[model samples]
Target: MARTLKTQVCIIGSGPSGLLLSQLLANAGIDTVVIDRKDRAHIEGRIRAGVLEQGTVTALEEAGAADRLHREGLPHDGFELAFDGDRHRIDLKALTGKTVTVYGQTEMTKDLFDKRHADGQIFFFDASDVSPRDLTTAKPRVAFTHGGESIIVECDYIAGCDGFHGVSRRAIPADVLRTFERVYPFGWLGILVERPPVSHELIYANHARGFALASMRSATRSRYYVQCDLKDDIADWSDDRFWEELATRLGADAAANLQTGPSFEKSIAPLRSFVAEPMRYGALFLAGDAAHIVPPTGAKGLNLAAADIRILSRALIAHYADGNDHHIDTYSETVLRRVWKVERFSWQLSTLMHQFPENSPFEKRMQRAEFDYLSGSETASRALAENYVGLPLD
Candidate 1:
């Protein structure tokens, strides 16, 4: 027998976006039920980008989910850009009066899971065949199977926060949906080790070989990446090989301090910029990666998801509290304005930091010139700083 339930909102996906949105709505006294196809352990184990903008921190705080984040997250004031065998710093706090927090996405997800788990409404590690129905109507319902039993959740609104591969975006009719995308020729091969980061702040390096980044999850856990052919397999990259390539890219001074250790995790992620138009289709609203994706170069993926949740949560709250749908009507437009800016920033940073196989000598010189201009020009540095910390949420 199919079990039936009712809530003010039905949220698909249990990622940080879905959990954060649910927590925010719950804070506003709105009822929500969350569903995901993966189990809790599997969800929390996925390593991802660690940089968080101030707006994202505020959102987590508002949802009462920032306790662990603040206690464990590292506050970074600036980061280094290495090129031409030299290092230049972008002082984020000095330029924008703001700093980003470096807390692993895995840890952040853990925090959300711990907080929401006590509420007893999240269905995880169990959901399958989840689908949204009657999204064109004022009331929408989500149906899925769990524990070999069918479940139907009817709600006034549905949130699609499942991510780029999720079912929510696919729920939108083919005629009504439009997509824009750019898939990069290379991918980032990343590793996680117990060693401390070489530098307290992140280092984004451009070298004759490719681009590399030195980031951290905590005081003792380091995350590093180097650009590689998109077709490159993880098996070809041993722990020693990755460390050697990273050292060469970071230049001498930074490389001299590099630590070596066995990697606990390693993976390759293809870079891409993707966006789906009109994030809302009647009562079904898309948020996070379900709506757009930016290359990780600018560290905008998670922050963009947070931005989407912030906008959609506010709109939903207004609809329920004052019966106003103004924000709801303009949800897609409002989010996309900020989304495109972040996309441009990500695209620019990826272009500046990576070596393309198709690059001619002229193109390479142009890249070098752009790097030199950015390194020497305070105005250019400030612009990068502003976008990196993030633009305004509203």
Candidate 2:
């Protein structure tokens, strides 16, 4: 016989989004159970974007999960952009009066996991055949097999924080769900090394060869990436070749400060921008990658997910706290408004900074023009800074 457990919210993934919402709602006196297909260590081992908008930092603090983040996160008042073999600063703090924090996504996920576990929150990791049912009905629940037994989690609502490939999003009827996507021709070949970063602030560089980004996880640990063909194999990119390409793209001034070392982690991740409309279908409301995916160009993936959860956690809290349905009714519209704007920023940045194979000379000139405009016009720089720091969540 299958065992039945009950909770107010059944989070369909245990990544940062699921863990964060569960943390917030749990603090709001609501009960939740998190379910994920991957085990704890597997999830923690995944390396991801580290840049955090100020709003994301606030959400973590509100959830009581920012203690270590504040201590360890690298705060940057501005980031540099490079083109035409020259580096320029955006002065994010001067223009927008907000800064971003560079704390590894893995570290943030571990923090959420630890905080949630200490609060006696429930989690089912390494579960198989996870499925959501009765989603269109008043009472929804999840079913999955775990530890040689079938288990059902009945809940008042279901939160689909599972990613793009997860099963939660598919629960919506085909006729009701709408999706848009763009698969870039290139991917980011990234490496994690123990050497210090080439720059104190992140640098997004555009060279005739391709695009390169100099980022870091901490004072002593560096993360770097250079654009590469999607078909390129990791074996082809040895330490020497990878560093050489990175240096060439970064130009002499910035590359002079770069410290080369053997990378412990290296991988190539293809770029894609995707979104699913009407984030809610029945009792299943999608958040994070389940509803949308932005290219890593602007480092918006994790921050966007946190935005969805912040809006979502507020709506869920209102539903249980005061029997209010206003926020719940308009959640998708509210979330998507900001979603498209952020998507635009990521897409625009990707277009302006990356060397597209099919781009014409006219397109290349237009890209250079935009870079030059930002270099001279404070207005243009402020616009970029505004989007980078993140727009207000409505």
Candidate 3:
């Protein structure tokens, strides 16, 4: 049997982007129905970026889902960048008058989920074969199967908040969609453990060996990463090995306060910068990873996604509240302008911090020289801080 439902907006994907969009729209008296291929538990359990730009925090606050975030998130005024056995602090607050919140994406999604659940927002979980149809028509529809029943959701607009591998982006015509990408030569091996972080704020380190980052979920729960070969297997990286490599890369000052323990979660993620052109096709708007992706070096993944939703929610709200399509008409252009800038920062930081495979001595010297410049010049350091704190959502 087939069933049909109607809403002003149909959001595909139940991640933070989709959830935040739905929440914001609902607050404006607009109704939305959310759907995802994965169930709620699966989405909530995935480990992801924890750094939240000030803009992201504001977006959550707008959605009224920052209660727990404000209560539990760590506020970092600055983070350390290391090279040649020394750490230089980029005081984000001093340089940009802003700070980033250290709240796990997993937890953010949970907060959004809780609010959506309380609001009685409709969601289809474990939805299979989800497809967006009639995007060019006045009415856009999403068809999917859930709980062994075929369902269709008809709406004025469709939001593809689904990630890179999701179906929403695929809904666009192949020839019409152009993509840009840069796949790095190495991957990051990250581990989450039940222990205090090596530093209260995040530390990004570059060493002769590789790159390492000491980050945290909270004051008590730590997350660490080290650059590694893409071919390396998780089974090969024992806790002792990971800790030893991390210490070597972070240097003695940070290592003095190191705490090592058995990691409950471990995984390796390949580094890449990807962006899909024209975030909108007909009436379907793509936001978050559905539109772009950045490397983890700049900690822009989740924050970038939230940035997308912020613009998107505002545009959608305008369309209904005042019948303004200017924002919607230029959503892709406006968002991409910000997206490319962030991508450049993430790529630059990744190139500066990581030990490239078969990197020449000259390249290494260049990296050292650049770090020295940043360490010496407040202008250079401030530039990095400005991007780290995040650019305005203009």
**Judged by TM-score, which candidate is best?**
2
Worst 10 residues of 2 by lDDT: 79-88
Q: Compose the digit string of candidate 1's lDDT tens values, residues 349-391.
A: 9999999999999999998998899889999999999999999
Q: Between which residue pairs do clashes occur in model 1?
A: 39-125
lDDT ranking from best to worst? 2, 3, 1
Candidate 3 TM-score, true structure as reference: 0.99
Q: How do the residues 15-62 of candidate 3 rate in per-residue lDDT, one tens digit apiece? A: 999999999999999999999999999999999999999999998999
For candidate 2, the lDDT comes to: 0.95
Q: For every model in order, what is the number of clashing pairs?
A: 1, 0, 0
Higher-TM-score candidate among 2 and 3? Answer: 2
The clash tally of candidate 2 reads: 0
TM-scores, each model vs. reference: 0.98, 0.99, 0.99
The number of the candidate with the highest lDDT is 2
RMSD in Å for all candidates: 1.0, 0.6, 0.8
